[model samples]
Target: MYVVIFRARIRQLDEDYRRSAERLRELALGRYGCLAFHALSEGEEEIALSYWPDEAAIRAWNNDPEHRQAQQLGRERWYAWHRVEVAQIERAYGAAP
Candidate 1:
């Protein structure tokens, strides 16, 4: 499995940002074969993690036009600084609640 982690120092967020964020997550889950997604924001920072079945799925989501547009908007307005990291999961274990 592949995992993408995004961390950012936020600038400001608005209605459009909220809408686009929701839409992008939906697209990832429904169309791009994203296995799971989680996002959290605290104070001025935000972190998002998404899991995929493989590298190809991750690449496709990254190259999606809507996601590209969101990236542009984030650079222009929503985020002060950001970093993205992609990694392969070698092992995972947890007990379901």
Candidate 2:
């Protein structure tokens, strides 16, 4: 498994940003083999972590047209600054109830 970490300093968020975010999450999980996705925001900062099977899936998702459009919109409107980091998961552990 691999994880993409997205950190952003938010500029503004509106209805269109919300809609686009939801749609993109669905599209990623349904079509791009995203294993899991999570995001959170505090004050003007946001962070998102998305899990993927491999680098190819990540690459495909990165090149998606709708995602590209969203990225552009993010640059223009929604985010003041953002950074994305991709890393391979060496191991994972959890407790189950």
Give the number of the best model, judged by lDDT. Answer: 2
lDDT of predicted model 2: 0.98
TM-score between candidate 1 and the true structure: 0.97
lDDT tens digits, residue span 1-97, model 2 = 9999999999999999999999999999999999999999999999999999999999999999999999999999999999999999998999932
Residue 39: error of model 2 in Å? 0.3
The clash number for model 1 is: 0
> In model 1, where do residues sit more than 4 Å from their true spots?
none
Clashes of each: 0, 0
What clash pairs does model 2 have? none
Please give the CA lDDT of all the candidate structures.
0.97, 0.98
Residues 10-93, model 1: lDDT tens digits:
999999999999999999999999999999999999999999999999999999999999999999999999999999999999
